[model samples]
Target: MPPLPAIEQPAAVFVARPGTAGRLGQAVSWRQLMVWPRWVTLAGFAIVVGAVWAVVLGVIAGAVLGVFCIVVSTGTALIRRGLTARRIMRGSLTVATPGMGMASRFGSGALDIAQANGITRLFYDRVRGIHVDRDIVVLRYAQLFIGFPRELFPDWAIELIRAHRAASGTTGYSANIPALPPIPPIEQPDVSMVADPGTAVAMARESFRVTLRSVAILSAIFAVLCLFLGRLLSHDHGLAAGLGLAVITTVWLLASAVRGGPKTRAAYQLSMPPGEPLSARFGSEAFEVRTASARIRHPYAAMTSMRAHGPAMVVRSGGIHVYPRELFPENAITHAGMVNKLLAK
Candidate 1:
């Protein structure tokens, strides 16, 4: 097995050269990312547009619109590929770090990768399959393939990844994989974020307000169209048509607020009461939160967006987690550092 290059700090394992994509090693292109997500929105637009058109026009028209829906999204995805590639090529460097995977006696079987956009932490346990080549290596995990170019990606790093993949009940193409180094020292937060009863409720209230602003604006636009149509089709007065829409809009607003406002606030409040402070622990591979209600875990690979909103570090994976900056250590782990450590959408 090939020996790994010298480590600068135990925390970081590998880092590519800067100022060029050739040195960045790994990149997730817009085309690859759009594969599954594009289908979701396309399907939605097709169903909605087709159904509405079918009711108003005819079945044939609805079917045509459904096909048109897919065509538009497909073209958009192709256009985005060039834009995304351009942004990725402008990368600085790619860094590989440790302490963010399945913690083992020898090592945490995780590869924390820094790319053009942000950090991507992949755990060996989650990797279902591996594809290795002379120039590139790709791991199949969670409905997507993450690729690493061997031209810039270190040999030792590749060996380490293949070895871990084999050990984690997965097969690797590499015939001889190197032994992993001992687990490095990891850092975790000792301070906990205590949830004030009022805080959660306030956050939920603000979220609902934001939701309302967007929804209401859209509803108003639709309402105007509805009024115009009603005048032409049903011969109804504009005021009567508008009034009917106003009632329906009111019901929609109430339903939307109820769905995510009160319930979400209650869930947040109950999960982390003052007595049971939420311990937001940072591991090399994942972010975990132990609350009174449940233990929530978010892998670094799954993180989509992160931002510091007001006094909180708001993170979005499949769901959202808001950590109060007043409680979370600011100097040790800066907002920029946190953003840089995870894959951000």
Candidate 2:
């Protein structure tokens, strides 16, 4: 009888779509799009912004403005989720770690990785958190996190990572230039995708509806607030403020209308093409999304809401994933709960 080694002596190489998985794993759920550290930063920003506005528009009004900024920022982040993931997930992934360092420092190892932008050596101790999302492991260190597919990393490898991750700390940006040991190799697969026209149109319509509804709600709230302010202030001041607020609100509405315009549709139509066979390996924790261009995973628990949109399946998780309904069964599905949930929703 013998005990297992930390991990296979040297390195275990893998071809991965780490960018999307890393981004996806950073979020536990759509509601928790921001990590605690980020939320703290946001809070600090709100306080500072609120304090500045408080002087101009009294306490309550000033506080409202600060909150509005926070909302806008969060909304922007949400809206950009799909775009960010798609952009970064493109191109090839480069990764390498010293065999000795990986084994010896299993409790505090490091990874040198490169993407479309550049290369970086991420120290395990600097990682903010480690999330084991089903078949993938994501080590999030501040603004950096790389997801390793479980298929590539064996049991001991994962344990090593877990051990190293458990001892993580922060030191700002992890080595960005990879002049260090275990420099990553670079290779790119020239590939392009244009989503299915039908799916694109459906997603576009759904996206437009969402934007329009959000803008409408915001417009209504703005009108009511402006009217209230008109009565709250003196005659001339109230009239002036009302006109200004009305103008501002109107401009915002117009801008939002344009956002859901043809440009948005074009983006949707651009991101996906006749995707090859998609593989969704369902398990207790999450599910894997495999295609010719990319292979990523999503935590089933992250699905905030699921609904039907024509022939599409609109899933609101870390972001809105609009899938053609027929695509679900094209590959594989193993989880009953997810199936049940999707069906129920």
Q: CA lDDT, every prediction?
A: 0.49, 0.48
**Which candidate ranks first by lDDT, i.e. highest?**
1
Summarize candidate 1's per-residue lDDT along 1-345 as a digit string, tens digits: 111123223233333333335322234453255467547856785687556655655576456656654775576567656554544443222222222111111124455443322233455655656666654555665334455555434556556556666776434533333333322222254556666766666556555555676677857765675455445434434345434544565565567566656555655565455655656555455555545544444555556665655655666653356655554455434542455565333
All candidates' TM-scores? 0.41, 0.40
C-alpha RMSD of candidate 2: 13.6
Clashing pairs in 2: 125-169, 194-272, 194-273, 195-272
| Candidate RMSDs in order | 11.2, 13.6
Please write out the lDDT profile of model 2 over residues 104-142, one tens digit for every residue: 112234654322122334555455566665655556653
Among the numbered candidates, top TM-score falls to 1
What is residue 327's positional error in candidate 1, in angstroms? 6.4
